[model samples]
Target: MKFAQPWGRQRLSFLLEKAASREAQTWRGYVAKKQTSQDADVSPAQRDEAVRWLTELHGRLQLYPETLVLAVSILDRFLAPIKVRPKYLRCIAVACFFLAAKTCEEDECVPSLKELAASSNCGCSPSEILRMERLILDKLDWDLHTATALDFLHIFHAMATASRSGFLDSIGLNRSQHLGLLTRRLYACLADHALMQLRGSVLALALISLELETCCPDWLALTIDLLRKAQMDSSALIRSRELVSRSLSTPRASLPPNTVYIYHPLQLAAPARRPLGTMETPRDQPALPQAAAGEESKAPPPSPKHLAHLQKVPLRCKASTKRKVEQMDVDDFYDGIKRLYNEDATSAVHEGATPGGGAYSGGSSPCPPLQPVGAS
Candidate 1:
């Protein structure tokens, strides 16, 4: 009864399917035209360089599959919008990772944009990462509901369990061991370098195949093989496994988060506290209660500054009630305001200060993106 008719579950699947359909359709033609047209640009060397960098990036972070998938999904989505070359390679990859960690990780301890900027060979500063994130989000049109590794985890679990329902139910399945192995295999999914290859969809497919091969091949792949339901060829699945192995063989392939990749996951421009002599910011400036306990929710009258910001997100409010900013014809202007206001408040508190106080700098750059290949 628990999973049966689970409220909103259907919606999740539907959204993921819709997004997948769109990515498939849009990319198919785009790939063909680019491949045939000399004007399409991007040489083999460039492609290899992109793949190697992405692979290096994937290796550097110690995130679980959940976080990695989120990062990868964000990168893929952002790729569609922001154009980059080896020149700005590390900056874009790092920016995308920051966005993904914020989106997926349960307990994040990454570094601040400033700290990362200090270490980056890319010469991109904290403000630069901050600016790039906004550009990335704008490029992707603020779509967040991508199918990360966690989403796929559930699917794989159900399929595996379904195949063994009788045996598992009767023998009292050691769900923990099984799940542990599955999670380790799942982490490997993040290593596919799908972000650079323009083959992220393959990563998901490859991950599922590897999980089956390593965990419960009988349940997942064997079942699929018997049913002949999957679209992938058996030989392709074998190649996917080999690639996963080859990725692991390269030690430089993945590494834990240091100043290089993982940031503190704090706000972008939050710590810029103005001197007391400065004029009080307009009704728009966002602020947070300084709960030394790091617990602001318990505060009784959490500064109206915080409340002033909450009312900014574009919730499902009636159009008549929405702000003039929200009513703007352009959707991103509406979104930028939300991030500048709502998330800025929360991100700022963690940053231990206020955002760049009312600079009003457009900080615009080339559009970047992240497409939730699994959802709308």
Candidate 2:
């Protein structure tokens, strides 16, 4: 159902009652504490529940781990502040995933709206499905472009694999192992379901770090786990995990998302766990900030002219086999291309005598291949 903006006195009182029922600190005290409490839907068991559902759904849909992680993020985000009844938890979580999929996947060809409603235990019609989509957008403050907690885990994995520590190098670990560790850590964070209490940029990183530390005490072990994921390269970030963690002590920006995120993982601290010669070395190393900045500043977004050129490029053409991939009905240009290319040598012979629009092998004069008799 479409809910009115929660600003009216009735809505405000509803929120107030929600806070009290959940024993959550009043919104008035949030500024002072800066630490979020376990949100109404956030708990050890709840996180596990969300993870299990997403993991299964993602597997069935054949989406990326990051995509599933995005679903988890949406669940955390919408459920973070609201105190929805437990009966509605599945509804809210499923709605968030549906919205997140539309946001991330260029192609939203998964299950139908009814299927999603069934999954969430809601018997909403397509119209209700559409309404919930709007409600979610309003609740999230439209911060859809920002990175999720899963991205941070990826950053950690990259740094861990890039570690030059004798311990890691001797074992000849790869990025796959690093990514594996990262995935485990992500799930394990839910083991305690402490993520809801985590907030902002660096603090969230610290909380995840603590959880990873607990799962496998050894730094090398965590590094090894990240090596196993294989989704991204771990080399670029190997030596910078510690520095990233230290800068995470206080977040400046959100470690940057996507490619820009790679350059400045974080600044280094004084010589400590990683010795200069042993594995952690920074003396002659290139300046990370400059490298990262250079990459980000390389070019501005495409201009209108460029966009026009891109638009001019047809999505598909008959001869253009690559970009011209067809869907549903395949007619028009495809038939023409096939007719023209029927026979390499029959061009002069057949000319415009072709019957059907598409090429025909059973024709009186079949076409020839793209070769002729002569030099090899």
Candidate 3:
């Protein structure tokens, strides 16, 4: 969504100031030490794994991207001052997630503690998470609201859009679509503990800069303008951009190539019903005579019934196949919309359907169907 004009510039300035002031106070990175050390600390790998776990839970729970960002911010902030044991890291992480949800999410939208614990599978009981939450609150001084990288990202993206107006249009994405893509990339950067050393504003700007460079010819000018406004060091941003670029561009592990075996349910359900040695050939069909060792055997021709059945099959594509293909495309479109909006498109479609589980008929509509925005 585009921010309102006039106030948009002022709001951006205000958020930049607030974030700059709070960034140093909130920024925290843990020392990656061996778990077996006498003073055990959260390792980088463990922290990344925990963040990945939270990311997965965030998608599964359908929580807002803001919630996940805030949760990670909280986790880092809490871990910065306090030295948590490696064993209790999961519990702490889960507690921070819960606390961030309570702070950023609506009262009705926040999941119950019991539900969060069970869903996250963080190896912590609800009571244990409650205890950790209390400890975290005490450590953080009950301040859960902090301007995260995501917050800065929103401000920067809005400012960029406001300045250019038609930049995203050229890229074939509306504001929401582009922002959603950047948000996902930011999430990936957050999972890497290496980028945690950089300030939130610098990291956010670096990501935006990298994206702008690919699409906007005047990306350097925009970057310098944002840097001046944010009061960020150019060198730091450059280093961050390099690190973020490398982190983002790093190849993901793919599954090894293997043949996929598909089994039909009906075949598996009654496997024993058909004896292994049994042949289903009709008795009326005579078997081919045994040929000489060097000769090829001739098989019987098809029966009239079989030929008739084969002739009945259409050569062209079936209507059902076309429908299936159309449905697949429709599903892909809705999936993109769901990623953009984080809404349950399936439930929305179900709600839009008729009571008889059919398409809408000629009548007054209860609600209008969702339309794609700025689709190319």
Candidate 4:
């Protein structure tokens, strides 16, 4: 029998949407949690050490993306219920990764107990590894399939790049590549406990949304709507976006040399841009006045295009005494990007088929891979 195409546009779109929604629900429902008070009992230094070791172990194994994510989720779930002693942290982490490799990776890809112990130098006996795996399974009720932000991120990328000709839509070519890079960065950020407060869907959607604004402005509205349909919490989404933007916009000079190395070579090659989509004014245009000696300067009036963009977004008002004017300027800048999307939407749809889409950098590392556990 002749087989049908694996990915007709409609079929692929449906599959992507379904996968996104299912994974989003699974992550938010089963795995999402605030940093537990129990974590406080363990010194931040100890937690950081364990996380760093886990990162090295994961990299050395060359594990699949799903395996690394699953292992980390297991570690989080296990720690949430009961605090393990600091000394055994590496052993527990190893067992978690070992179990994850078995479940999510091919048999050939999974490492043997002896190999794992030697590589990590944790001195965990095979029997100890088995016992810890059993303990973790019992604590987690054997629910080893927790979805991660990377799960949703993959679905979103497929959807954004969906094409009938087995090629990525050119309109989103740059975006798809940039989104992949940002997604990897988010995974790197996962090593940080503060970012862990966000659920998978929120983090994935926020990073995707921001990249869409930067590289595929035309797709911004549709992506946002799909994300909202996927049940991303509104407040969480905003906070996640701000966090991503902040991290991306931070000056390289301000970041530690090691922190900068976590990014893919593409990210490392480019200088960081300002947050909130601030564009450089034409040099010929008059510069805006500085803020008055003590009081804040009034923001320049936004053009009509900027007003229209704000009209598209759901607005919120929170009263604050400090930096109120600066906040308004930031709001105006985002609104302008939304308007840019509206203007470019038609052109993007008409010229969808373009060869040679954006290229993604290989390999992944967490953002600022090493830092003081609670520095930020």
TM-score of 4: 0.56
Writing each residue's lDDT as its tens digit, candidate 4 over 1-376 gives 0112335556655755676665655443333334456543454445545665677787777777677777777787677656566667878989988988899887887899889988988877888988988998898788787667776676555555552213335444444455546555765666656566677767777777775665554655656665655655667777888876775565631343366445555545643443232333345766445554124423333445535554443333233444455566675665565455443332343232223322112233233223235855
> What's the residue-level lDDT of 141 in candidate 3?
89
Please, what are the lDDT tens digits per residue for candidate 1 over residues 66-163? 55556556655555443455456567767877776676555445656665566444578878888888888787778755545445344445544555
After superposition, which runs of candidate 1 have C-alpha atoms over 4 Å from their true positions? 1-64, 80-83, 106-111, 118-122, 165-202, 210-221, 225-376
TM-score of each: 0.44, 0.40, 0.64, 0.56
RMSD per candidate (Å) reads: 32.6, 29.4, 27.0, 32.0
Among these predicted structures, which one has the highest TM-score? Answer: 3
**lDDT per residue as tens, model 2, 1-376:** 0112214434433443342333222111111112245543344455456566656566566655556666766666565565554555555666767776776665755567777676545545666667766777798776554455555554443344344334444545544554555464454343234334442222224433443454444765554444443222344334234444443344422221232444656777843332111112246765457577566323222224423343233322222344233421233433344355552333343444444443334444566433335986
Q: For residues 182-291, could you state the per-residue lDDT of candidate 3 as single tens digits?
A: 99899889888888888788889998999999888899999999999998788999899999998888754111124366887654553223321122333576644456
C-alpha displacement of 131 in model 3, angstroms?
Answer: 0.6
| Ranking of predictions according to lDDT | 3, 4, 1, 2
Candidate 1 weakest ten by summed lDDT? 26-35
Candidate 4 deviant stretches above 4 angstroms: 1-40, 43-45, 163-180, 247-376
Better of 1 and 4 by lDDT: 4
Q: Indicate the worst ten consecutive residues by lDDT in candidate 3.
A: 270-279
Q: Which stretches of candidate 3 lie over 4 Å from their true place?
A: 1-7, 29-39, 253-376
| 2 versus 3: better TM-score goes to | 3
Clashing residue pairs in candidate 3 (N, C-alpha, C atoms within 3 angstroms)? none
